[model samples]
Target: MTEQKQETKCITLKGSAVLLKEYLLYGINSILYQRGIYPPETFEPAEQFGLCILMSTDPKIKNFFDNVLGQIQEWLIQRIVEKVTLVILNVNTKEVLEKWDFKVDYETVSSNGNADDNGDGKFIEVGSKDTKTIQKEIREVIRQITGTVSFLPLLDCLCSFDILTYTKPECDIPKDWDETDPVFIANSQEVKLRSFSTSIHKMDTIVSYRNT
Candidate 1:
């Protein structure tokens, strides 16, 4: 009889608190989906959507981002939930709270590598973070982690403290949701604006999830 050895699972993102702080904000503004919208097979360059990201100097906002990012990373690599590509940030409290303008496109679209002109080559307000650089960086990061596994398309959406996730035709189950305990969030949509911390660090993990 041959004895079998069990392989230990690696915690790549947990040890480092801000798992994706160093990453470029490409996926933040893009969504992904398979070519046929089915499963297992997708097209090249992938189907994409727009998204945004924002943060404030508020302690609660800081805590929220940390918790959300950490949980998502745990699911992405550990649980292999592949969905979402781009994200957008909305630091302007008034705009988000009062107006609730969550749309991703400002004017037009373009095919050029520049996501800033956004494939339109036209002048626009609030452009993306330059797709040329961010896309390459994203692919490199994914390759490092996923190796050669296929991932679903993600349509980047407005990044807020609210419950945002990547999904498919079915809204019930997110395309890349974690299989862990239910995450109870209270007053998640409400947020306070602030500046980026000195640096993304481990000391910034969120302990409380619900209304605290």
Candidate 2:
């Protein structure tokens, strides 16, 4: 019998960005459901990253994420985005209640000639790691976010969430998007969640809340 060879998985920049965007999409949905930003009945059960996740069914909310994450994916491909934050605030007082920061780091690509090299002597960043491993890591991060309800302070007031994308200074800002000051939680308690990497890009997540 002939020996079987394992097929190599090649991860390009565009593929990496798509994976990151998917994580953000499901991750934000999980947060909204767990934090009670909307009525529990408004969300429906969905499966992602091998976990049953609750996703928002509200049309406005769904539209919001689609637009925001779309721009973010482009930035991720250009390696211009720094962090994407989901800020939870009191609708009445505009007080920041919680902040979830998804920080991005571009992995260094080796210059040594390999399969990733183009004919022009320039190397394209490529990830050889299997997608299954990356998805497993994402699963753990989502699980941690779900577990945060245990220790996080109850958001008793009406709360709203805004997504902020931090990009490099050289990055061009879209006309529809305005520059806003970063939100911070006063006297905060922070918990860093497990991070996942696609070999081309590494992501770290941290959640902060007001200390009471």
Candidate 3:
């Protein structure tokens, strides 16, 4: 039996930027243009989006293009997004940013308006530490982000998206999926979390989780 060589293309930062451009602009611009706030002819989704990211990387390269192609991220969120996510998948460009970097990253600087959370604001604290509440809040965030991204035309432009979602009603995860979270063994082979939500998060081990 001979295995065929897989024609896999490298996942680079450029690919991520390309996807980001579409997901961040077209859907938002289309709605804004219909609202008559921004002129129809002036609303160049692809070009504007491409220029925004390009401007961030190299403002000098665009020369005078920077003046016409000002970055507009907050506008997109204000017009078309109830929620937003910055997904980075390595495909072409070499310099990938660190985790949680986008949490504070912004294209347009606000005029003495805010410095904390980069204007995203702190997540509201929901009372009750029950597992149901945790799951509900997480699911709500997921629902919002998914809804936002569904309008994006370039969702298929990704090699893969690695995710870790945990859900359980007494361990009510997807039952048929024959996948288990990674675990490690110590001297006590039969070790378990002493109680629900009582275990410490380890560097390289799955910790048991519960609402209580």
Candidate 4:
């Protein structure tokens, strides 16, 4: 008897957009917990992407992430966002200590749309990829995120994090969004981590820390 091959299906643009947003949210939360940016007790371990992941349970933190990821999803669908950066800084000195850069690539989207454009312009047909395969890739990225603690410097001082999105120059900025300069680390060491793609979108992860 021959084994039957499972058929793969292409996800819709809307579905891909949601998946990408969730990935970013979870990835940020994972980094926050792993880097000891917040109290470990504030997060609870939960199963996701075939791995036990820690997620923030505090109401204020949850709400903030919701608002940020909501707007990010909007930009993602329109394919205007180029990169999402998580900047960790020393609260006292207001100096950047570490940076987690998630570079985004819209594999099947057009480049002609403005940031204010709401309509889906020149839709690219998404190719088929197995859901399990995507999950496996995500699991690997998560493992890398967790392992980064071994190399990253100890954040002995008080620290805070800021989320920044790099978008097209023509993209309209919301009232809540303000222009800010990129927070770069001095004498930094960078490490490139594993990346995963959902056929329609690809995200590459990089971490830069202040070399002590």
The most accurate candidate by TM-score is: 2
lDDT of 4: 0.83
| lDDT comparing candidate 2 with the true structure | 0.89
Superposed by TM-score, candidate 2 places the C-alpha of residue 84 at a distance from the truth, in angstroms, of 0.4
Location of the lowest summed lDDT over 10 successive residues in candidate 3: 195-204
Instruction: State TM-scores per candidate.
Output: 0.25, 0.90, 0.21, 0.87
Rank all candidate structures by their lDDT, best first, as comma-separated numbers. 2, 4, 1, 3
Clashing residue pairs in candidate 4 (N, C-alpha, C atoms within 3 angstroms): none
Of the candidates numbered 1 and 2, which has the greater lDDT value? Answer: 2
> Which is superior by lDDT, 3 or 4?
4
Per-residue lDDT of candidate 2, residues 1-212 (tens digit): 22222224556677789999999999999999999999999999998899999999999999998889999999998999999999999999999999999999999643334444346765656676667888999999999999999999999999999999999999988899989998888899999999999888899999999999
Off by over 4 Å in 3: 1-9, 41-212
Per-residue accuracy of model 4 over 57-172 as CA lDDT, tens digit each: 98988998899889988887778989999999999999999999999987754322323224555544454566678778888998999998888889999999989999988789
The lDDT values for all models are: 0.28, 0.89, 0.25, 0.83
Alpha-carbon shift of residue 68 in model 4 (angstroms): 0.8
- Residue 67 C-alpha lDDT in model 3: 26
What would the TM-score be for candidate 4 when compared with the true structure? Answer: 0.87
Candidate 4 deviant stretches above 4 angstroms: 1-7, 109-124
Model 4, clash count?
0
Off by over 4 Å in 1: 1-55, 85-163, 167-212
lDDT (tens digit, per residue) of candidate 1 on 1-212: 12221112111222222223333122221111211112223222332212222223345644655665555555432323323222222345312211111111112222223233246654222222333333344344333223211332231333242334343232345455453322333443322111111121111111121122
